[model samples]
Target: MMKINQHILDFAKVFIAINLCLVIYSFAFESMHWLLNTQVAFFSSLFITIASFLSYKRNIQSRISNLDMSKTSKTEDRDKIDEIDDPYDLYTEYEEIPEEELTPEKIKEIINDEKSKVRKDSFKNTLFSAGGFLSIYRVLGYGSLLFGFFALNNNGIFLPIAFMIGLGVVPLGVLASKLLFKKL
Candidate 1:
């Protein structure tokens, strides 16, 4: 699990490196020349912003895959526990025992334990999904905002268009997230 997490961290670092390079390239070359026309600047910024968002999505997917691998191991451990000899097993020697054989408190404890596990798992899954959504939103939001600023400073014509498109990112992202959540 640690190894998987380390690999995910490394992957994230690589993404950061690539994003940095893109940022430098945009500022040094593309931003300077592409800002001549409002339409061109708006479109260019939109394209780059989408590309950055896709890159972030890929990074998140890699991390999720790693997490899923770790979760599989945990499920295996649970399966092992289920297989172990226990009085609760239907095929065990204690199968003939009456319902009253187990104390009421013990039965309640078992039920509570199962309920807790379910609640914990649900919480974890919800948190993971929410975190992923927020991360994507942040990446898209900031990228679009920055691109809009560059477009506005370079070409007056594209300023309104760029800003409008940039503002649209949040709603688009929210819609996409909702669709994704529904599909999941």
Candidate 2:
């Protein structure tokens, strides 16, 4: 399952890379050159980069939100009476069972069971989310790099600007990876 997820994430990263390249090529050769000023190229590239990042964030948020446990809880009918009535009766019947009746061995067993469950759940979620964010960050980082290349190549007048933007991407990528790791 994790491998499959990683594969899917890899595909997404590649797709984003291709899309970014296309955007850069189009901006450099097709549309903005006719606009006269290099500002048009700069702003157009900036807008595309920002829009892509926003869309990526939106996609991640939407996916995570859909997977939220709160939504499942909200749809569940806790007020349903008859379904729980028998369990209530059984609990009442067992009410006389003393707390001291639970042996240390049984308590230890239950604690271990709960701990194992928690660990498994944590591992699964971490793996899945890490895969997701790894893919996302890769896409964003590479896309930004590609855009920087385009900006540098087409607008020699804005070379310093493009250089700074390109150089800035490295730290941004690191920060993003760190944050994503923490989240996972």
Candidate 3:
């Protein structure tokens, strides 16, 4: 994880530098058409922002801790009191295997435990991002706005459409998402 983080940080520096150059060139030259314009960047940024926000929420979520079998005894002297009165198996248990009996097959359980933790935490976050994004709407919205307003010179028609979909859709989508997930 640390290695990947270091590699991404190194790549991000170059990526930011190129974007800076592109911004400067777009403004400095009149005839030079910027391949990626402000509208495109705005839509991209919006999608990225939404994804990052969801990821941030996922990162802070804590999973149920698994038991370390070595510390606990195999024998149950008596039934423990259930204060919560819930029958759900929250923390998973592992049968304590003798250290000398630890083979290649037993090691898979340890690997699977870690993998399960990661997958469980990220499941909802992954589902949210899979369908929700601005790019799909932006390509359909931004291109039409720029063409209908700028090319055809109809500010009156374009402004309302742009503002409603551009500014309004995010909140509406978020509300819809919350309702769908029962998070509201």
What TM-score fits each model? 0.30, 0.33, 0.27
Q: Which stretches of candidate 1 lie over 4 Å from their true place?
A: 1-60, 67-98, 136-184
What is the lDDT for 26 in model 2? Answer: 50
Q: Write the per-residue lDDT of candidate 3 for residues 23-127, one digit (tens) a residue.
A: 565568622223233334434444555455555444444221443433443224323443133224334355788899888877898889999989985996675
All candidates: CA RMSD (Å)? 12.4, 13.9, 15.8
Question: Candidate 3's C-alpha lDDT?
Answer: 0.46
The residue ranges of model 2 lying beyond 4 angstroms of the native Cα positions read: 1-77, 80-98, 136-184
Clashing pairs in 3: none
- The lDDT values for all models are 0.52, 0.51, 0.46
Report the alpha-carbon TM-score of model 3 versus the true structure.
0.27
Q: State the lDDT at 70 in candidate 3.
A: 32
Ranked by TM-score, top first: 2, 1, 3
RMSD of 2: 13.9
